[model samples]
Target: MIIPEQTRNNLEFDKLLKWLSSYAHSSLAKRIILKLEPFDSLENIQTRNKLISQCITLINEEGKYSFHGLANIIPILKKARIEGTYLSSAELYTVYRQCLLYSSIKQYIKQNKAIVPDLYALVEEIYEPSDFMRSIKATISEHGEIFDIASDKLLKIRKEIKEIAASVTTHLESFISDKNNAQLIQEPLVLDRDGRYVLLIKAEKRKEINGIIHGSSASGAAYYCELLSTVELNNKLKVIKEKEKDVCREILQKFTNSIRGIANELIINQRRSAKLDSLHCLATFAIEQGGCMAHFNNSSVLELEEVFHPLLKYKSSMIRKSAIVALSLKLEEPARGLIITGPNMGGKTVALKNIGLAVLMAHSGIPVIARRVSIPYLKALFADIGEKQDLMQNLSTFSSHVQNIIPMLNYSEEGALFIIDELGTGTDPSEGAPLAVAILEHLLFRRGLIITTTHHNAVKIYAESKEELINASMDFDISTLKPTFKIIPGIAGTSHAFDIATKLGVAETIVEKARSIRDKKDEAYLSVLEKLSEQMRDLEIKKEVWWKEKNQLEQKLRMSIEENSEQKKLLLEERRKLSERVKEFLRKSKSRWEEVVQEMKAALSEKAYSEGKQSIKEIEQEAETVLKVSIYQDEEPGQFGVND
Candidate 1:
């Protein structure tokens, strides 16, 4: 069956996909699926994906880090900043916005100073974005040039206002329809004084419109009166129209020059941001890859006594018994495969996942707690253990099992860890047991680390007979009627199914009869199983002791390293202090020479200069003495009081 990459489970995997959809301007989900190749739980993927989405949303919405918020947003912002055209650093953008607002408000106060009464009065006139406003904020979010143009619109408008006001002016005049009245005006014939005519002629108004024209007034008198009311109304409209016209012209002129310049800047930033984002993505990818590598690297990567499932620790509060399964015998070479034989619900599946996950976590640069685990560096990991079925292929339980196993058998390279739960269980025992043994042999030949759980006696017997394979199983406590997940080597595991059934209140007659039927032929083999089980218990204790010792040693080593680093820091500080003192001494000698000479003359009277040569020698000796004292006298750490 063809299984898509989406089949695997990661923590919040779906949410991660969604987050990636929003981020990187590309489908991050597909990248995640491709990077984290194998599957363990759909839930793991879903949860992990959700975490990523939450991280992006948290950064995009709140702009604050909760715990490792910066760690999460750094990659995204870095990606956005470098690879994204017109990408802005969120923090830097915020600062840039503040700077812009400061400049704008300052300019507004300076330019509109004549109109606004005060600071607050001007603020009242200026537009502020409302809380409910729902438009895209940053212009040129996609195109660099367009955003730049939109952002600079206000400045362009201001420039336009200056350009148009240079030629326009206001003029005042009166009209007279009577030719006799026209004689009073003299000089030129005052154009149209047609009072009722459409006020079609556009000329500069020289004064405020306050009153009405008289005598020649016709039916249009009331309309003309309305038009000529106040100077305030006329001037404001003219200014507005002129500014608008000039602004349009400026924008058209700039359109040709600014596009390529802005686009280049945007592209550069986009590439840079993408590179930074790639580094962060690589780190996360490493974590996922490393987890898979741990198991596949070592042949006998066992969590002997105190093994815990990395993923399961948070799932249940109930106490769990740890199990051990050894495939070291299978590892004749450095990497060997192990076949684990145990009953149903005997912690077999848990063991398989634990081993796989532990190795994976280790490879990811995380520490794993194990009594003793031998690990090699592995390149890839494939796990097919629990609830893996191919309904799409219309395959049954047995068919699905075979399909899953085929990949491990065919594609797995040497030094890879392959884990299977209840191997060869879906078919008849006769066929499945032999099939399971054959697969184990094939894997062994290839030197792949194979850990399989089984209930078949034939498989267990087969492993025991082979010098290259070892048998291990989980123990059962008869008194408690509980499966004591303790694993024992060189032992065949008993299912204890009947005992468990009896403890669960199965019919007494059926329990007794079943016990009687089984007690006849395999008595000798069961005896060996009991001895091997005892030995497995002892191995568990030894494993725990070894783990404690290893932890203690590691702690001591860490402490020693820290101390050494601190010592080095102290030595460097001492050297710096010494250098500073020497510099201070040299400076003091030049600055305080007069004071030193006066003090020296007072100490060595007239006799000091009795002989010219002797005086010179005495002065030289005094200078040398001062230098020696300055160098030898211990100054306080970081202090440099240079005295001449």
Candidate 2:
């Protein structure tokens, strides 16, 4: 999306950028954040926002991670990219530290990949040069010093130098201890002068020292001289020291060559790391500011719920969160323009700026400070906020405003946003109000989404008359004679100038005289607007009460449903237990019947035919009585038989 420079300045977008940059870990990341612009494609914007969201998740799951060792390695990498150029030990240490940071981040992302897949994906694109890091760690110390173990030859040379230096010191001590030469020496202590051991000797006894004089002291009373006995040892030590330096140089060059081999990978890793750092800053800032990514739609409708001016949070240290009033606005089909009317210092301009900033922030892939928001992707954003008087061009405020607006009108397109504050105010109201109406109509006809503030009653009336326009106002408290800083849509606003003046200690007589001299038609219109504002306020209170009652009812309904579900579960469990008891009772009754039938058969086999018939009859009667008793004993009161 193309946002004009003037619009960005007018909305104080740079202030937000500054806030974002403050959370960056390095200069590279800060630079990237400061130069952020709105992406032109929805896919890119969504990707950026998703990455930030993932970062937020990571921070919440694990406490914020510190990138302490991360540094801008671009300059060092550039030098390494050139052939035969070796980085200094300190510079190479910086590169190593950055590599370690990369590895740490890679591991961190891998551990939390399940929670932050998008962040993991972003880190996965960067190369992890484990071999390169191991080489650096083996060569350089954590304190940016080259270690003695860097190379075999360097170590061997250092060992020889250490032995020779000890031998040279031994020779110097032996010469000093000899009583024959003790008087020639002014002081026995040896001093290191330009990497060679020397001794202080009396200037008058210099000829008796038999040594090479390095220099004389400040008073010229003493001479610093190297003893002749240690001269050969000192020369060997000097030659070995030079050799040690050559070995150290070779080690550093070899390390630098290794870095150069992977210079391209390092460059790519640095860029990706910087981008991740920027994402971290953005996510942190969003969380601090109570922000969320707004839903984007392809339609022209714009909806904002409980939206506040983002800068208001930093406006004053004494300002509490509750002191900032959030406003809600919705512009759908046929309402292409919103005309806000209110008295001076009533926050009409603030509302306009907030809307513009919200759009810009959302388009730039930054979360907006709002409870809920859904905005269309705007092709262009043009704003005419604050005074535009151009002293350099000798143009009046009205001329400058017109000049700034002419291009906006020409470039008006579908899905474009235009925010104008105190529109058509620099010229005479008689002409400016009608001109403002005409301009608004033209912009709406071109299908541009517009939000403009005006104090002109003509513009407000014209907005009320048009189906394509909606009239809104910054709410004022009549009892307190102060602006509430709350925006109310679908109604015009009264200036309430006289009432406010009276409250501010102006004489009642002045207020009455001013009111009487006002135009009758304008006064009547303001009176209606005041009454309408009162009705709107009452309606808002009623709506809030209704919403609370509705939520309570919904909660109660959910509880009822859950209670019913639990009762059903318990009822089914009880039925299963009762069924098992019935099955056991039936099994015992069948065994009793089988025992009676066997007794009847035994009686028939032992007696005549007539006796057998009598015996069977007796058994049948006994079995029927036993069956009835068993049924009565097993069944509970009010419970039917097995069929039930």
Candidate 3:
């Protein structure tokens, strides 16, 4: 839940957050996403899952409703306080528009219950008992002006002002157009200044006009003055507007009081709407990028099938024929850890980082990018996967990594997943390997899941020695001297370091000299491990074929039984019709039964159908073709010989 800021940056979680928030329509929704944390309880987590699932179903099946006004009105709801609020007419109109929007959303969801029942429950919270919009509409017009029908006293004053305004305009118009005053007036149009109607008259004729002098124009040649007759009525209209404001204030206060009474309910509704917005955004994101909901279990097991590193997948999308591959891993009670070993750039670090980021994603209630994943309730997920050299703190990468692990392991308990990369590389391998083993032993007693990537032979050996720990490796193709990026479980891996260097244009003589400098026993040990890795890869391929055949056989048996039963029923009907031909039909039925038995035997036998399957060599050849592998030349093929 509390993902360290550094960890977030390491996983590029901020970028992921931005991607998710981009789908959100409201600022409140975006804010909620920014502040997302893991739920406290299993029930709470499941509840969130249910809501998200329903929203996904809604958007994926039926199109989403218009979320236009919802975002605009969210600020008003956020601004509304718990204590009380005296909403202004503009603010009240905001609440009114939200009322209409929610009402429409509710109506739309009503017909889509089959698609989204849980979503409907969220929408139901936003429906109010009172028609808030009706009250707002009755008092205020479309232009935010208070209507005359709002109050009788206000209406009477406005009517009287209108009649007085007409009388003032008539007098002003007649005086301006007259031939006697034609030279006196600047223009015939009358202008209203501060609620008083005035005429722009010639400065020389200003004294002649029978009007009270108000003000003179900029040129000082003409005067802008109000007539003596309209002054008293202008005063009346000003007083009436004040009264109208008081009346409007009283109406708004009463409206605010009504809102305050339902303030608690409104807040709850506001929260629900925010929740719905979040669901909508997540659902849309999931649909956009193929993502699956994770399954939960009571058992303390970690399983991931076909899981993609989300950020990596996004990056791979930029290139044509993207080369990013998904990862699959599992750790149950019996196997607490796995040591991933391979040549350089074999994706060992990526695999470790991938697991850590994905667990964090799931922990924070986000749908992970996987075809299928099942995880138990984890206390936490601890990761020490990347380079953490701190120059400011004067810490080397090894010391930084050690500092992280020491404290994490001190407080670590059962039900946590710990991931580390390059476990014994940054320090002396002699001491680091033993230290890593010690750490693993300590974590094992705690019953936590531990996974680490290493090129250390000692680490791989230690892993193989423990039943609780397993060894896995990212496969490197020997012929091409390129990493295959395939994880081969339960097998130790060779570094394949010198081979890669030679392929990358290091002189063959220099590579051979480096290999010879290594202890012969170590060389023999690594060569054995490399052979074992290859054997394990072949075994894995065979195991897959075996499982595939088993599943197919089971399916065939099931279908055969069903079809056989149906055929027996039809034959029984025929037997009932022809008593004379029963024996002949029985003979034919026996022959058909023999054929079915033979077919079943052939389908079940391993050797009988194995011939039709392609050899592992052919599979590898095709894979090499697809990858366009470059095979480096060797001085002596299949022999680990040194060149002079």
Candidate 4:
């Protein structure tokens, strides 16, 4: 879809170019401009015309020293093209003269050591090619003297032209100043190898006023004047041209390196241009919206919400108020297949598209807007969602669906993503459901992610039977009678055929009859022998929960026992520290006692020797009393280590 042309898109593109320029080196940009110098652009009309005129004077004044390279000229040319306004005839002529002068002088300066005109200061450069040619033609026009031009007349005309030529020659110095002199001179002078003058005589010069000199009265005056000037100028031009060539060559050499350096610098400095990022985003959005690159895988699943397609951004605003639906699938036990049943216009098709688009986007490395997006790398994506009916193939929708699906079965990989919309609603559900069920079963065995929307209750039951399959449905608010666009998991709606009809304002009797029929169908499905067995298994889930609870309790008990044991070990360590303190105290007491007892024994023995009385009974009784003091022991378990 083409986005409508708008000011915004144009502005965006301009911004992009500007950003690109930022990364381009100034030198390289110059080279590019030089390459484009010959090309016509806006600048030549307005600014560059003036610049070229001025630059010619400068070049002449400075000789060839100030000359730069064509490499250095490109930027100016580009700027003129992109931003220049307009050029006038006068300005064109000025530029034409300047360019020719520059080109001519460049040659002359090289051959002789002569002073050249200040080319940079000359405003007139090479003007429009057609204008240059026209100017050249104007200088060569011939007019015979009125009723004359015999042999004497030719010699007189030649003499008259030479004097006019000398006068014009002197005016060459004023090429920058004599604007009127430029008008008097015919444009585009032609010169030969010897620089001889060729002139075109005007008839009016023959009628010259007596004793009066008019600018035009001189025959071939402009042509002779330009040639005489050129020959003299050539002397100076020879040296200037040589110097200019050397200067330009040197400048070109330096300019090339600078360009490369600048390019590298810009790339390094502006590598992350916003314009580049924006383009990347746009590309990704396009891929996602266009559903051009989606993939499916086993481990990763994408939960896509209200996703807008990018390709359609310009053509039409995508179904904008579409509700955000949560959708995802993965390869696991219960089932990778989804059975979706809803009324017409319930957005089943849109949902399918959204899923396909989101997958495509994720694989393309683009951002997706979803509450959550977990996508695995998918090997391939196969989808059969749109309408298919072809008389050429003599195939109905059902036949087409089968034809598309049966082949998929052969190539179905374990890591592929598949999207099937309206799986069993194209034909009779009785036959379609069983076929759909068989297909789902086979796909489940392949261990790939599959999402299929079906209208058959039997498919839902089949899904419920397998623990791997999870039932989900698009929510429809019965009051508003609209598909809410919200996908709710694990709840099937029984299609809400009659409920929706009632909300649609159907007659009460008709609604009642429809509900009656729907209920009967629901009852038959619910009461089926296979369904009955599953119901019985579901009712017995409480027993399973009880067993699970018991196992959890035992595990908790074991953890608690381990916690208590750790706590007891901490208490025993505290007791050991107390016992150590008690042992330290006993040791200190014993050391003091030893010192006291030794001193006492020494005094008693000395006194006994002096008094000749041992007093053995008294000494022994005192020792016995000291040793009999009260002693207490710790009440807890004893430790025999150093502290205890």
**Number of the top TM-score candidate:** 2
In order, candidate lDDTs are: 0.45, 0.78, 0.70, 0.44
What are the per-residue Cα lDDT tens digits for candidate 1 across 1-644? 12223222312224433332232322332343334433354344333333333333333343422111112223433343343133332432332232234334444344534433333232333332321111123422322222334436645664554443331212223333435434333222222233121122112221233334332224422223212432344455456656654554454333323322333333333333332233234324333322111232323443333445544442332256443233112233432556665556667666676666555544433233443444555544556677656689788777887877776777646656667778788789889989988988887787666677887777766775565666677665766765555555545686667767887899999998887787443544554455445544643554455445444433443344435646545544554454455446445543443443344344333442122224234433443343332212225543222222
Tens digits of lDDT, candidate 4, 80-175 = 233223222233233334334334433433333233223222212322234433442342222311111222433454455456445544544455
Model 2 lDDT per residue over 1-644, tens place = 98888999999999978877888887888999899898998888889989999999898889677765567787887898788778888888888888888888888888999999988887886777777778888888878777888878888888898998898888888888999978888888888877888888999999987789999989999999998887898889889889987887787888888888888888888888888888888888778877888789878889988887777766643465456777789998878888888887787888888899889999999888888889888889999998888999899999989987987888946778989888888999999988898899889888899899998988887776677788888887766766777888777787778888888899999999999999876775576566556655654664455445444433443344436646644544544554444345445644654454444344323332233335335433433332221112124533322211
Model 1 bad stretches (over 4 Å): 1-310, 314-335, 358-374, 377-380, 387-394, 412-415, 475-490, 519-523, 542-644
Per-residue lDDT, model 2, residue 595, is 53
Worst 10-residue lDDT window, candidate 1? 64-73
How many steric overlaps are in each model, in order? Answer: 38, 0, 0, 63
Could you tell me which 10 consecutive residues in candidate 4 have the lowest summed lDDT? 1-10
Greater lDDT among 1 and 3 belongs to 3
Query: Which sections of candidate 4 miss by over 4 Å?
Result: 1-231, 234-333, 375-377, 390-395, 497-519, 523-644
Poorest stretch of ten by lDDT in candidate 2: 625-634
lDDT of 1: 0.45
Q: Order of candidates by TM-score, top first?
A: 2, 3, 1, 4
| CA lDDT, candidate 1, residue 147 | 33
By lDDT, the candidates rank as 2, 3, 1, 4
Superposed by TM-score, candidate 3 places the C-alpha of residue 639 at a distance from the truth, in angstroms, of 57
- C-alpha-based local distance difference test score of model 3: 0.70
TM-score list, all predictions: 0.47, 0.82, 0.76, 0.42
